[model samples]
Target: MKAIVLGTLMAAVAATGATFSKSAEANELALSLCTYVQGDDTMRMRKKLRDSRVRVRDIYSGIQCNGQSLLQFAMSNGSQDIGEFIVGRLSVDELKSSGDYEWAQSNGHAGSPIAAAIKERAGL
Candidate 1:
């Protein structure tokens, strides 16, 4: 069996914050810009955006992990800044089909950014 992956990365996570690894393979080391969103750090997100144009739009509009889009992940996890950014970037169809916007809306999560941003746009 593979190594049990047990030790808490919590301290490191709390120190650096959200989804990271040390001494990873080259492929694994290629960081995702969505990480900043997942981290809920606008400053780091903006910094990453300025630093590289690589997967930003695709990640914002389309990328998915474990049955959820970046927007889905952001909203589910209460990352509003990132969710608002995703709201600005993604199309309605994209949100409907891929970003979990519909689920979030119907689920009545008061803190869900997808629902909140759309409602805000409509001046509700």
Candidate 2:
């Protein structure tokens, strides 16, 4: 029984990974850039995202490249951790004034996983 349970858990994890793999490509790229920002490449990522051609907002609206952006990748994957790092480093105003906040409060995504993370770090 224990072996069966472990196998089932592993299978579930694998399936979840597969599902996340199918997520929007732009969102995924944005998340990757977020990770890079959270890592040591904040400057490079910021510059890249700032380019007019980079429109992560289309994938998940309410994302603007101002220093105020609270954009994040999918929480179930590695994006959440990177997001947390970026949130910790960003200023309070940036966190509070992010488009994610408006979208979360106005839309039904109030407790959205990513928004929740931003709020938690931003102290909003």
Candidate 3:
């Protein structure tokens, strides 16, 4: 179901030359992730979180707005459920080793999924 929806979205976007948003810069998976974050589509994101097509590793580093991560972007955009969901799914090493994660860490962002979850939970 997730794959089908993603494929359809990809095909439709490609055919229409439509972009998910101005902030996505036409990145395929980024568009999906961004939308998944903002659209409250938890079902699709659960599958895509580990999907190679979504490139979770690569997305770790993309900073659409002032170096905010997908998780950060999502929660801020009012998708707390999705943010917490993905954060709970990912491991510390996976989040840390991703090229962008360390950068975000250095920049004072929560670089670990669990940590981010904690921070959000504490209302920090």
- Compare the candidates by TM-score and give the number of the best one: 1
Candidates sorted by TM-score, best first: 1, 3, 2
The segments of candidate 2 whose C-alpha lies over 4 angstroms from its true place after superposition are 1-78, 105-109
The digit string of per-residue lDDT tens for model 1 on 32-93 reads 54566678876776666666554454545434544566666777678888778766765555
- Each candidate structure's TM-score, on Cα atoms with residue i matched to residue i, is 0.55, 0.36, 0.47
Off by over 4 Å in 1: 1-31, 106-111, 119-124
Which predicted model would earn the best lDDT? 3
Counting only residues 3 or more apart in sequence or on different chains, how many pairs clash (N, Cα, C under 3 Å) in candidate 1? 0
Q: Write the per-residue lDDT of candidate 2 for residues 1-124, one digit (tens) a residue.
A: 9999999999999999887875665565656564564454655655666663553333334442333343433332334544555565556766675555666566555665666777777777
lDDT of 3 by residue, 40-124 (tens): 6888876665564444544566536335667667645667677677665555565554433344356455555534664454444
Cα RMSDs, all models: 11.6, 14.4, 11.7
Error of 2 at 101 (Å): 1.9
Candidate 3 error regions (>4 Å): 1-26, 47-58, 63-67, 93-116, 119-124
> How well does candidate 2 match the true structure in TM-score terms?
0.36
Q: Supply candidate 3's per-residue lDDT for 110.
A: 53
Considering summed lDDT, which 10 consecutive residues are worst modelled in model 3?
95-104
